[model samples]
Target: MALVAAAVTYLLVPLVRVFALRIGAAPEIRERDVHTVRTPRLGGLAMYAGMLAGLFVASRLEHIGAKLADPRVGDGQTVIALALAGGVIVLTGFLDDWWGMDALIKLGGQIAAAGLLVAFNVTLLWIPLPNGGTVSLDSTLRTIITILVVVVSINAVNFVDGLDGLAAGIVCIAALATFAWTIALTENLEQGRLSVTAAITAILIGMCLGFLPHNFHPAKIFMGDTGAMLIGLLLATSVVTVTGTVNYDIAHREINRFPVVLPILLPLAVMVLPLADLIMAVVRRTSYGKSPFAPDRGHLHHRLLQIGHSHRRTVLIMYAWTFLFAATVVGLSVGGVPLIVFPLVVLFALVVLMMMGLPLWRSGRGGRGSGGSHSARRGPAPGSGPTTEDPSVPGAAASPHAPATTG
Candidate 1:
């Protein structure tokens, strides 16, 4: 499956680049946008093409083919539903990329796609109780919940795409966590669960891996709404399919027997960042009497930069935080204690806090290069400088157009 995904992505990259160029799908850098330059936004086509190619190849594999042929493996309905729903979301995003669509319309489409999945009998059937018994949610409630998940995940990813590689990186981390949880379950049960989950994850991983080179800092191409929505759909579908498959009783039994909170926690843990960001954004926007979808430069990344962190530093910090949280969740699942894991997580968080505080410390130092940072060009800093040039600094003497300094 991994090989298939890799191959598909390898072939699809150029195709997507060409398609994006042909469509003139380039992102125009705006005031609120981070990039200073325009970049092609064809990554969605690449990702979707990779997904289809990988799935198609995997489906043709003899072992998987046999399974699909058999009605015993739950009727192949889930796979079909996934493909159809993903296609819907991908097309909607693709269209939006071509002719920008309103948030409400996009959201309505997402809900409708999710509703289609529910109609195909792919709804969450059960909920494991905290204590013992299982509670089965009604179809209507399940549909609503499923639709909400799809919409939330789609928008959360869309919101997080401000920084190059940010959204892709987060989704990749979440996918890895979900893949691990699913594989663990399959191993625990000694069943066929791993194949589907692993295959799905491999395709996504390959797509991100293949695209990251072009999507990283100073990105040559932006995934734009198209890539973001495609990824969001994939992520949403993976979570629902994996979690929805867990029978309430089975989850309850596992919880009663051992520490099976891992299964329930895994998906939530993987998605915590995007979910939290979305919730916070909505709350913040609503408080100002603005629509939740209103655009702003107040995302987590923006805050990280607002206080003086460099762009690269801010992105790296977010990645580190994401990795640490994911690691903490994995550690807990691996039988680490609340006593141990909590402390370790806290310790890790403290390190991040210190890193986050470093900018303030630096600012307090007056940009003086306190630790041998070229001795501030041996001049009275900026405003304090004399009419004569600070000959020591490069270009300070030739200041025909000194860059304007923001307070």
Candidate 2:
């Protein structure tokens, strides 16, 4: 039944994509923006509308509703809170999409929305210590942390939407991982707990799957801040509701031991790409004495393209990394794999990343010097070619802007 609802919503996203394009919600190629052609930007509305429809169906299903009626059924109220807060955040972002808002204002709205979640008890209160004690935080600290998580996750998704299907693909990978983990850990618990999380995860997966066709390389539409922010908010809220708010401990005593820390880990796994991107963005930004939120071409995806990766190739590389990470965590939990799996996966990813870096290495643009073994051509400076454009800057090309294209 839930699957049926997801399928229904999944089909609806493309139609919405078409509608977005017709409504003048398109992304223009700017100096700071990366793409070449103008693409519709309100892809999030279709996604959210479909997701809401799916959830509504799930909530109304007789069998599903009977199980969810219990207060402990996957913390339905928390999910509701998530949906409500997400609606607000989505609206905030849509407004930004239509009429640009300053970074501080957008951030302020994100923080406030997160604060609302904390009010609903969607938060982490205590962390399990390595030495057997629990680390309990004060309300203020908890609030601050929760707000940061919400805001950061929102922007992280926003940041990664630079390339076609990149953010959606990474998100789909992360959700699959976290969804698998949630089910594995809580399968023996209450009835609908798994179902609710599974339902929401399925909806997210479906929406992304449906949207990707239109969002991939040669994308006809962009998710923009509207889609990106909403998707991020939904992912963040799902993490909180499934990992933090769900009462898995009542059915499995061992889970309660770690409490806060375990929940944190789940969200971290679910948002690995965005979190990594956020940290990298901050490090790169601060290193040059610029505001952390300042727009720049230092994003992970940007660097990948700068090294001669094509748009499609760059998106695929990110997809591979995300899937690899997701598989690692799921393997740890379900395959009953040992800690060694972490190092093994990390090594494999690095090897692949190095191969991806070979082009840059050969071109002498791998962050060292323009002195590698690729065809000797004194091309424009790094990020100077037509391929790399500042998404935030105006007068940029929509497609790959490079001196000579190399797929």
Candidate 3:
């Protein structure tokens, strides 16, 4: 399924780029914009198509099909809900990409998408607590919690999309982490070869992998709002599914757990970067008496740049942080690494990375060098470097004349 999704998305991106250019659908460059040209966006549509292809194939395979045939994962409800909700976000994102959208409307789309899943019973059945206790939520609470997760996750991805390959790479790492935990958990429980969370995560991971070649620094295309929100929704769906049918009681008794909260915590730990970014953004925006949706260049990535890190270096740094945090949590949870050595290893790695970046810091402090970033001087290749469809502002537009941003 993953290979299928990756291949399909990889093949579809260039075609989508051409379509975007021919239609003249691109964002206007704005302040803090880095790309020299307003490249075409909506590559997300291609990603969506790729993921759907994977799902289509999975529905037919006897092993995966059997899982999908079960009511919680299959019975046509959960899968259909994911597809329809994803379609809704894709349409909303497409509209935002072509002509921009009100932040409220974009949020509404996210809510509706999440609500669609809840209506189909694709929601958190309960939350696990640290003491091995379970907090069973009522229907009303479940609905509210699920919608909140959807909204937060959507915005988190959108906020982190400032760098080319940044959001995609981060999300891919998250899915990989999630897949690791899910697959391990199911295996520990002797629950066949795959779980719904693991299966969907496989497809999502493939989507990101396929999209990355085109989205990497010196990117050929941007996923825009369409892709960011779509991936966010898919990620939340994967997390939510874990809580639905898993016999937590059995698992609780089954595995030699670490913190007992790891199941509920591991995915969030994997997503710490985006979630932390979202929280900081809200606090930062609101502190200035602005709406939480207000746009600014104070994001974490921006801070890295402010400190003189090159665009590419800043992105790589963020990836390392994400991987370290995620890997440590998973390692401890699965008992794959000694807990005592984990922190020591992380400290050593951080020291090394920080030391290597010292030259960039000194150069940036003196205003003499800024990672020698030439992104502002370089133009996108013909039919590449898509304009960002940003929803950071309440009513951000895709101005064709504006220079392209790092997106």
Compare the candidates by lDDT and give the number of the best one: 3
Model 1: lowest-lDDT 10 consecutive positions? 398-407
Predict model 3's lDDT versus the native: 0.71
* Best candidate, TM-score: 3
The model with the greater TM-score, 1 or 3, is 3
Ranking by lDDT: 3, 2, 1
lDDT of each: 0.60, 0.60, 0.71
Q: Which stretches of candidate 3 lie over 4 Å from their true place?
A: 29-34, 74-76, 257-260, 336-407
> How displaced is residue 25 in candidate 1, in Å?
2.0
Write candidate 2's Cα lDDT for 147-230 as tens digits: 777777777777677667788888878777767766766653444455555666767777677677767766666666666776
Report the C-alpha lDDT of model 1 over 5-69, residue by residue, as the tens digit.
Answer: 55665567667767777786654434323234555665777777777777777788887555433
Residue 250 miss distance in model 3 (angstroms): 1.3
Error of model 3, residue 69, in angstroms: 2.3
User: Which segments of candidate 2 are over 4 A away from where they belong?
Assistant: 1-23, 27-35, 66-76, 125-142, 188-192, 243-262, 337-352, 363-407
What TM-score does structure 2 among the candidates reach?
Answer: 0.78
